[model samples]
Target: MAKKKALTNVELCKGCRLCVGACPVGAIEALMQVNKKGYEIIRVDEDKCIGCGNCYTMCPDYVFSIEEV
Candidate 1:
């Protein structure tokens, strides 16, 4: 098994879709739905993340990060 990071802000996310495209492993998916403020959100697949931090850099909502545990 490989080390995996935790992603959040499913509802608060702005859904820029950068993270989805930024994922080198092609692990991210952009969903179509409004948040509390009517902004789009992103969902990540745990099985696909390679802890590459590509999504973390492209995200404006601060939704993804790696835990060094």
Candidate 2:
């Protein structure tokens, strides 16, 4: 069986940081970089993510997508 991971859509992110706090494993982190919309984006550590979908459920911008790796 393949492992699952979370992917991020940088363009859709509004830098709300809800997902950051919602992540159970601290896999998500805020970057100094900003998207085209001038909102700060987040990066996901695929190795640390457990596919719990916490970030997906918490984010209002729908930034996270889960897939098998």
Candidate 3:
């Protein structure tokens, strides 16, 4: 089976951190860098992500997009 992955839109994200809390595999982390909007962005650790969609489901701003790779 193909591996599952998550893509984040830093500019669209609201930095709510719901995705970070919802992830069962702890695949997401807050990056030190901020986007042009000045909101802290998150990234998925591909090695750890299971793409369970928890992050996608929890994000209120629709920042995450998931796919199989």
Candidate 4:
């Protein structure tokens, strides 16, 4: 199987928790620091992520990018 990954662009995130709720594997978490856009951004735990793209699909702000590696 091809390795997959999820990338989060903090700048575009709007502190929405939809992606966190949508993630099936529970791979995402909110960090303490806010981004330049003044929103708390999410961090993807690549080790736990299955690259399912749930985050990408659910995010209103288009904060997530997924691809095969």
Q: How many clashes (backbone N, Cα, C below 3 Å) per candidate?
A: 0, 0, 0, 0
**Highest TM-score: which candidate?**
2
Could you tell me which residue pairs clash in candidate 1?
none
List, residue by residue over 11-39, the lDDT tens digit for candidate 4.
99889789888889899998888999789
* Clashing residue pairs, backbone N/CA/C < 3 A, model 3: none
Identify the runs in model 3 with alpha carbons over 4 angstroms from their true place: none
lDDT of each: 0.75, 0.93, 0.87, 0.89
Give each model a TM-score.
0.78, 0.94, 0.90, 0.92
Over 4 Å off, model 4: none
Ten-residue region with minimum lDDT total, candidate 2: 1-10
**lDDT measured at residue 65 in model 3 versus the true structure, 0 to 100:** 91
- Cα lDDT for residue 62, candidate 4: 85
**Model 1 residue 68 CA deviation in Å:** 4.6
What shift in Å separates residue 55 of candidate 4 from its native position after superposition? 0.4
Number of clashes in model 4? Answer: 0
Q: What is the alpha-carbon lDDT of model 3 when measured against the actual structure? A: 0.87
Ranked by TM-score from best down, the candidates are 2, 4, 3, 1
